[model samples]
Target: MVATQQTAGLSTSGRAVQAVALLLGFYLLAAAIVLGLLGLDLALYLGSDHLRPALFKIWALTAVVIYPVLRVVFLTRRPKGGESGGLLVGRAEQPALWARVDRLAERTGVRGPAEIRLTAEVNAAVREDTRLLGLIPGKRHLEIGVPLLIGLTEAELDAVLAHEFGHYSNQDVRLAGITVAGRTAIVHTIGTLHERADRQQAEDAAELRAEAEDRLARGKQPKDRSAGDGGVQRVLARLFTRYARLYFRVSESVGRRQEYAADRAAAEIAGRDATASALRKIPTLVAAQNFYLGAYATLGWDAGLLPAPGQVYGGFAKLLADPGRRAELAAMGLALPEREADPYDSHPPIAQRVAAIEALPADGRGTEGAGPALDVLHEPERTLAELEAVTLVPEAATKRRVDWPELVAESHLAHAREAAQPILRALTGSGLPGTVDALLDAVDRGEGRQLAERLPRSAAATAATGRAAREFLRPALRAGTARLVVLALAESGLARWELSWSAAPALVLPEGMAETFDAALDAVVADTPDTAPLRSLLVAAGLAPVAG
Candidate 1:
């Protein structure tokens, strides 16, 4: 494998030094070529007599490209951006976690992290603060995601951490800053110049269109030839794109090899079986984590509500640990991964990584069976919640906090209240008051079909007319009617939304109303007029009786 060959020939420090020299020299080389063009332009100016005026135009054109290339060489995150936003903690607060990391770093043959931080992502990474195009390493940082702590066991966590530490041990992190910054500069430069070229082209086209319009009005034929501003910058963008592709092809090819080397190191440190299991289970954990955040954690997020303090991120562990969820996640993890190999992808497919890890000859390292990874932290719930508050969402600080139950119920009600808006609009649009009573009144008056036809329904229903249209709209009408009735009931204390982990928010009806409620909704929107029974139910709930 290319990975094996790369690591075998060069020492870790040698690879790092070579990468730094290669990328930094590549940037300098580009700068020199640009200077060469200007130098030749000066030579033509000083030595030639006939091409003197044309050189002025050449200078003007070359000046446009020189600044962007030089700017990329100098600016463009020379220090490779500041430390990412996260909850930074030290050994004093989490000594047990620190000890584990220090030992791993020692065994992995690298200096231990200068800082450990927690983030909200479902991933972990190690980065360095480097100087002079990543030639000298400064402070190092390791960021661990809380979900990994919550979902993985100690052995799997060890494999994941070791994989990231392997990047350092192989010196992958050292030149990573320089290579990433270079590629970033090229991409930004291309995007910036192309944007200006597009705008200029648009403005020139607009001017030409206006001239043509004026000529047409004056009873003259429009000119066929275009006399517009040339896209010199567009041509420059294409050149940069060609060069940038070469940089990516070189750096990312090395990056993919580094991933293989890291996976091998992780397998050696934490056992091949544990490493492979972690690789497969990670995707499932990420899926479950995203689902938990969307479905359960942020149920009341948009309504300016969040779970009670220390419960937001901590609650995900409870969901993952639930007896019902464990079986489902286990089943999900067994499914085979289907991913196409992309040449530009920095990491190989999970299947490939697992196969490579398993191919190694038997090593004595084995899973520790050390229980949950969360045991690494002292009071993990507090740590998770603290990270959630600072880094999870920007608007979290201003949101009102409530227990999970109230948050779930209130959020559904808030959604229900919002969904009611369109139904009310449909009612008011059809010349009826936006109320369930008015809808029922129209049905009793034998014009329910006409009213249903007018309001916008589903695509299948909208395509029909006459009796078929009414039939198509029947289910939707019943559902919409139930929403209006439920909102009224919820407001009047006859209905409420209950939290359901396995399903959507279940609307709980009052006692003695559960069995006939669905049929009553159907009857109200049926072909035949049947208001007596349905209206009777609402009247008993203290709604006024229909007047003659």
Candidate 2:
């Protein structure tokens, strides 16, 4: 009833605009077809010279151009075929997920998507792909972002799925697909123009470069200039962009209204608070996943060990372990600009959506079996690992799971070997321990700054037993070489790597090692109050602080 009321309440003016937008989309394609037919008719008429010879020739040329463009634009392609982004989660492969979708659709009073798929994005959406100009039902697909699945609670996920279904309920999916096609057509035409212009520009630039080289050989000054789109191309691009913008101005309002209606429908079916909570968490969840990826890289973990789909929640949990950090991230997500929405923005601000959702009465309509949403898929870990191997991790890296300690240890040893080279060159059989000691003493005496500079940060730090030898290192290396230095440091007991539930890796110091090192470093740099030397020393020692 809420959905029906919302649809019925759409202003007459808005309905008229929607009609206009749909008509506009259809007319563009219809005009192309009509033009093609007119061109064909003109071509046949021209053979008889029924009109003046000059006029016939002009019509013939116009027809020749129009027919081909029309064929390319409409006749050669079906709107239904193309790679829509995401991994298709078929009913056979993920029956539970399909079942859940069907149940939610029934409750929401709408047909579910024709297909379901998984994505690596941070949000879920419903989309339609077809060529019937919004008149014929197209293949509607539901894309559920894996991160969202992992981060949101089961109820929240259901609300999100329901919200997407609401769009289908209102027939917005078909309308959006038509608008997308309209936009694509305009973009395609403009792109062709730009491509031609760019080709001409590139040729012009090559000629200019050659001319300048010849002028230089002849000892003459070459004129300075730039190559750009030809005037015709520039005009055409501008016209298309402007025309599309105008059409979107009318159409975008329709889109935004549809979104609001969908939201209302979703709130009615899925419970208002569930939908609101889902909206609230989306930004933070996305940021948390981003943090997980960054931390994985910073920790020097093998990319092949991309967090399993199930582990995404673990990563997000680890990231927000600190209350302050959690609040900070939440604040960042909520901090939208205090300005009106961009005319082109397809979605409204999160704050606005949440506020609206909050206004709806609670329905208390959660499904009984809404346990951990991950259970809907079979062998999620294997599925995620496979996705990672294909999309992110190199095939070679996929075979092994290298944790943080191994990564750090590997980085340390590699750097130690490189750092030893120059010291060995200078000391000539002084032995590794003695040579390293001498370098540290020189650093203490401010005499071996350059020598310290030559060595890795892990190798440069003076090694000492007990608590006095506290140090940190950040490998200034990439890929495989990066982890060797950390490994060496761990092996030598100069620093210990702490592998934990946290996404960020850290160095585990013996009781008070951090304090001892901090105090010693503070004393060493106290006079000048400059820590660059200490920082460099730590890097040389293989104990640079890992970035979180």
Candidate 3:
């Protein structure tokens, strides 16, 4: 009877694991096949019959090697065997919080005790060790991060903890960790390969340019160069770019799906309502985590630990503020309470997950449908308003003004100094600042058009100065309704001009607005004859004009 029961339990667990594994495996395989075909096409175009074959072989080998390595890495990384030394735990001043965790564990019948830890960001996870490697034979331990502990209410916290314990009850944590780790490792490897390819291409281009210069100096015509070189370069660049994009997409999809499986496991082990509440709280947590990560990066703590804060904030804020981004976020089901399994995404989109939870039957037992609605964790109105208040402005409109001739001279000097050190060593074996400066000046004049066209984007630090200027001029502009008064700033090299009211308040001009503004500015500038005269008159009258 004992042997029969053990066999039946094993069969049940295998079936559950197989069902999820097959679905996710099929999705990943299809993506890999598509990427392989594209990579093959690229290789063939570059005239690398041997290289193409080798690339495919390596790709296949990585897929095999990466999968197992990722599994092992993830499984081993978690806080297991009561390893709480590295984590910040037991630092909470609230005695009630510890009492709550103990009570919940008892109510859920968890064999392992849950340890609470704190982090600056808002996130919580139930970490455990199941001794899959057999060193401790079924010994289990649970750990909870502080961010989630402090962020959620008592009931919400309980629900989250229960959902984590659900992983233990369902025995899904072991497999979940492996899958998450494997996917991360594979994506990281692909990114590294793409970067290496880019570096190689850059080196090749530099070498080609040097060779071409030598040939030209020796009186060889451009037509004397070998055919197909341009085509080969273009093909190589295109192939690498395509491969990089596709690889990232595949990795993102895998990550999305993995999240869904974890969520499903949580719902099965705890309750549907608890899972739904946890999902709802994620966006706020993500925002807070991003803020802290940005703070660290700005202080130059570690570049590898976070994305550039400005870029991350700008991108996310744009997504949140724009109507289109709002719609997209909504479509992802950010406000919903159901879950839908997506084969393409590793995690089901938030909307789908919410739906899945809502669909569960109210019988208080696992069934084919979602459960009853839990209390919604609505964000404070003030918080939502604050997010809405953040804005993005055009870069060109807010750049600082500089004298074009002086700026060009400085750039020339810098470039000449850079080139002089190498040339001096190769020739006279001594660096001359005067000679370097002269050379740089000549190069700058020659490359003036190119530099002008690639003008720097507006600096965020300069926006405040620009805004002060706009505020000073606002009353004057509003005085006359005959024509819309727009302020124009000259480009660094005087190649072109851009207009703005203030960076934040983008002045939307009607059709033919530029022509009208140009005519007006031309008349004013023509009368004044110099930008300094006009700027002085405006500033003397309390208007602050910012120029680049």
Compare candidates 2 and 3 on TM-score and give the better one.
2
Tell me the tens digit of each residue's lDDT in model 1 across 481-543.
788887777777677888766566688877667777877887887768586776767777665
Per-prediction backbone clash count: 0, 36, 34
The top-ranked prediction according to lDDT is 1
Q: How close is candidate 3 to the true structure, as a TM-score?
A: 0.42
Candidate 1 segments whose C-alpha is farther than 4 A from its true place: 1-29, 32-48, 51-59, 64-79, 198-230, 361-367, 428-433, 457-476, 511-518, 536-548
The total number of steric clashes, by the backbone 3 Å criterion, in model 1 comes to 0
Q: Write one digit per residue (lDDT tens) for candidate 3, span 370-445.
A: 3211112122222222222332223422333233233233333333344333333322222222232222232234
Question: What is the C-alpha lDDT profile of model 2 across 1-548, one tens digit per residue?
Answer: 99866756465335545655654764475476457667776777766646666766766666654554455444554344466666777888888788889998999887678888787778898877755666567667888887776666677788888888888877777667666666666666666656656777888889899999999999999889777665445554565567667766666767777777778876776678777777888878777778766654333333234343434333444455557666776687567344576676667767787778888766766443355566666787765554444444345454344544564455434445554454444333333233333434444555333333344445435453333323221112111122332343555677665554443346664444454455434544333333354345456565644432
lDDT of each: 0.79, 0.60, 0.42
Where model 3 places Cα greater than 4 Å from the true spot, the runs are 1-87, 91-95, 113-115, 128-151, 221-275, 284-334, 337-344, 361-548
Best prediction by TM-score:
1
